[model samples]
Target chain A: MEGSDKFFVVVIVMSIIFTGLGTYLFLIDRKLSRIEKKLKEFRGSKNNDK
Target chain B: MIKSMWWKFLGLALVLYSIIAGLLIDVPALPVIHQTIRNLFYHVSMWFAMFVMLGTSLVYSIRYLSGFRMRDDLMASGAVYTGIFFGLMGLMTGMIWAKFTWGDFWTNDPQLNGAAVSMMAYLAYAVLRGSIDEVAMRARISAVYNIFAFMLLVIFLGVLPRLADSSLHPGKGGNTSTMEGLDMTMRMVFYPAALGWILIACWLLQLHTRRRALIQGIH
Candidate 1:
């Protein structure tokens, strides 16, 4: 590829990587909070039954 | 009390020095806007903090594995949190610098990819900690996983990217260390800026760790 074309290609790749990372973290944070809530509820129920 | 006061004074001095150096330093004529070089103070300092915190976390991880102590786990967690903070700051400052100098907000250069990988590995450390219920089990598993994550960070941030290709980043590939180009006046300021930023990061780590310990003790 030409020099300018190569630079642009690299730039596109970087932008995608950054945006994808931010999105992935946002999704994971949401999912983890849900799982934590369920786990807290389950543990509470177990303690009450004892 | 005396020690704390000493550190406070030292930190103050460092901050003043960094600010002065950043304002006074001269740059040769380049295509990029001049003031953007100021980001170097914040960007490099945060990376130093990240590396230091990650190293500390790795040490605590090993301690937790061998001793099964809750304190070790707490220390590891504190380091990871601090590491995350510095990593984010580094990423932000780097992105801002890139935007100004490169004329884009982001790009897929080898160095940038390596930095992204390092951040992701640190994120995984937090996820791993949350996965386990019991403290002992969590410590054991997180500690083991941390070793892997730390290695990945070393490889991704340190070795692999540098080996890949040329980067616009200074002090990489054939680029000379910009530090040497700086006159004595710049060095006088630059050293203090580095010192000040690292001191603040260390203070944050210590404060968080101490607070966690107090909470644990009270419970």
Candidate 2:
């Protein structure tokens, strides 16, 4: 392959990898935030009884 | 958060727009760039959406710091996460366009570097939030860091790209392109794509925030 073509392939690969990583992080952020909210609500109710 | 009717309306509009942009508009073909122009619909739209989200989130962060309210913190978090989504969309679409137009995937160019830096800063925001366990303390610290991050994002995305000496993309460093060769149909498609994607971003953020509230209320 020509140098430019090889470079293009590399760039595409990097883009795919980074895009995947970003998507994964986006999912994790939502999941963790939900968990945090649940814990907060639980603590809030517990404190209300006391 | 928006109601279900909001999404239904937005979805219908998107579908109609797709038909108009694709079939009704006689978009000029850039043979050199091939299908790269298609990426414009996604890439440019996402950048604008990201900017809006980050700006909104920064506002909430400041409010949280001033008042120490939990709702502000939640809003700030919502904006940040949505901003990250738009950022990813922009990067992915840009990469595809770069591959065809530049005959390579990566250019080590100014715009690319700026975008990469902004993404890293946002990632750091998440990490910074994670490091602090106490709600009040976390919100305050993250707000301070977010202010710095917003400054960096503005500089990287808006200022540096224009002021720098080198770049691959067009409209870099004070140079603007006129619609010298663009046809009417291209304009129609381009305008709607930009507007439609922005609406979609806003709509998604509302849905996400509502879902969070619902889950919070139920448990």
- Deviation of model 2 at B6, angstroms: 4.1
Whole-model lDDT values for every prediction: 0.71, 0.70
| Candidate 1: tens digits of C-alpha lDDT, residues A1-50 | 12443554554554466456435644544454465566668778999999
Minimal lDDT window, size 10, model 2 chain B: B18-27
Clashing residue pairs in candidate 2 are B162-B173
Chain A vs. native, model 2, TM-score: 0.75
Per-residue alpha-carbon lDDT of candidate 1 for residues B52-133, written as tens digits (9 for 90 to 100): 8889999999988888878888888899899899989889988888888888878877777777787888798888888888
lDDT, candidate 2, at B150: 89
Q: Once superposed on the true structure, which residue ranges of model 1 sit more than 4 Å away at CA?
A: A1-50, B174-182
For model 1 the local lDDT of residue B204 reads 67
Best by lDDT: 1
